[model samples]
Target: MMFRQLFDHASCTYTYLIADPVINAAILVDPVLEQVDRDLKLLDELGLTLQFCLETHIHADHVTGTGKLRDIAGCLGIVPQGAQASCADRYIQDLELLELGKVIIQALATPGHTDNHMAYMVNGNLILTGDALLIRGCGRTDFQGGDAGTLYDTITQRLFTLPDTTLVYPGHDYRGFTASTIGEEKQWNLRIVGRDRDSFVQFMSHLDLPDPKKMMEAIPANEECGRVSVVV
Candidate 1:
């Protein structure tokens, strides 16, 4: 198993690369459009063939590199079946398993931040949580059909059920913190650690976070697989 975590400072987004050493095949999760060159360089340096460019959800911050990667590298673009990312070549459902040589990536339909959000569990040990579960705070559920109660369920009922030692790699983090264990989050994530549904809802309701600055542009481009403008 080979893995690398790449970061986009502008949006605080984290992109993940995981490959099967035996076959030299790789998958990228939550790719950013502007970073396509860097990702490709890394893949080439490692002598890996790009098999899939996966999206955890349609992002509102940074446009996705799925289409470009596919066009240039001849890889498939995959997203959650309900993401409505019309430009993607394939959409996967909950529990669907994607194989890269010997590595298996399992989809977990844990919606909340966005109604179609999906987290990938790799080999039952590492979880690429996207926006669903963060280190000390989870994603906000105030837009894109977000529901606090549903998010609460996804966290307490689904993610927390994972093995305590499962390594959690979140999609974004504002602070310098990087990587956390399920057990640590269970104990320290103030937003959902000990709060009940109602309390969590109340807390999230008052957050009042401003929408991402790039939301207007990024969301549309992401849905269209990074086409900044559609040609009629």
Candidate 2:
């Protein structure tokens, strides 16, 4: 198994490249439109074929590269079941496994940041926590059908129950931190460590966060698999 974490500085988004090197097959998770060339170039350099481009949810921060990559690389575009993206080639349901040779990626429904979000657990050792759980802080639950209570439940129950050594790779991080362990987060994550469900809900309600700058453009575009304008 081969894994690489790529970053798009503009949106503070983390795009993951996970591959089964024995078969030279790869999957790109949460790709950004502006960084397609970079991702493709790396794939080329690594001697790998892009098999799938997967999205955790419809993002509000930056446009996705799935549409373009599908057009260029001819890879399948996969999204969580019930997501609004009609352009996806496949819809992955909770607990469904996508296997690449010996490596396995399992989708877990963890919808709070967005109503259709999923967190992927790779080979049962690491999890790609897309917008549902960040390093020290979690995603904001103010829009796009977000529910703070659900988020709290997701973090404390679904995620925290994983092995203490499981690695956490978040979708985005404003701070310089890269990754954390489940045990570390449970002990130190300021957002969830000490707060109960009600306190967490009340606190998230008062964050007063401004909308992502690209929300208007990104949401509609993402629903169409990141096409700036739909053909129909």
Candidate 3:
């Protein structure tokens, strides 16, 4: 397997490119529109064909590159079923397995940060936790129908249950840190470490974060797979 973690400094977004060595069939998760050229360059340099672009949810911070990449790479776009993104070629269900060459990526429904968020389980060892779980802190649950209790349950019951050694690759990280493990997060994640559901809910309820700068544009653009203007 070949793996690369690409970052968009502007939005603090992490895009993952994973490929199977046998055929160079690859899939990209959480690609940003501005980074399409860079991602395409990487694919070109590696001689890999993009088979799919997977979106965890309809992001509010930055526009996703799903449609552009699909048009350029001739790949399919997939999002969680709950995202209500008709622009996607298809929507994945929980526990559904998507195959890229010899590699299999399984989608896990772990909603909280958003009503339809999903974390991808890849090859049994790595988890791409979109925004449900971050490096040392979890995603803010102040909007998009976010619920703190659900996020708490997601962390403790769904994500924490994985093997302690499972690698965690988050969707976004403001800090420069790269990756963490299930055990590391469980023991040290400030938001979920020592708090119960109620406390966690209370903690998240007061975040008071300002809305994303690009929300007004990004939300509508992203729903159509990042087209600045959707004709249809």
Off by over 4 Å in 3: 230-232
Count clashes in each candidate, considering only residues at least 3 apart in sequence or on different chains.
0, 0, 0
Models 1 onward score TM values of: 0.97, 0.98, 0.97
Return the clash pairs for model 2, or none.
Answer: none
lDDT (CA) per prediction: 0.91, 0.94, 0.91
lDDT winner, 1 or 2: 2
Q: Whose lDDT is higher: candidate 2's or candidate 3's?
A: 2
Candidate 1: which stretches are off by over 4 Å? 229-232
User: How much is the lDDT of residue 124 in candidate 2?
Assistant: 90
Instruction: Give the Cα error of residue 96 in candidate 1, in Å.
Output: 0.8
lDDT of 2: 0.94
RMSD of 1: 2.1
Candidate 3's residue-wise lDDT over 1-232, tens digit each?
8889999988999999999978988999999998999999999999999999999888999999988999899999999987868888989999999987778899999889998999999999999999999999888887787889998999999999999999999999998989999999988999898899999999898888999987888888988999776322
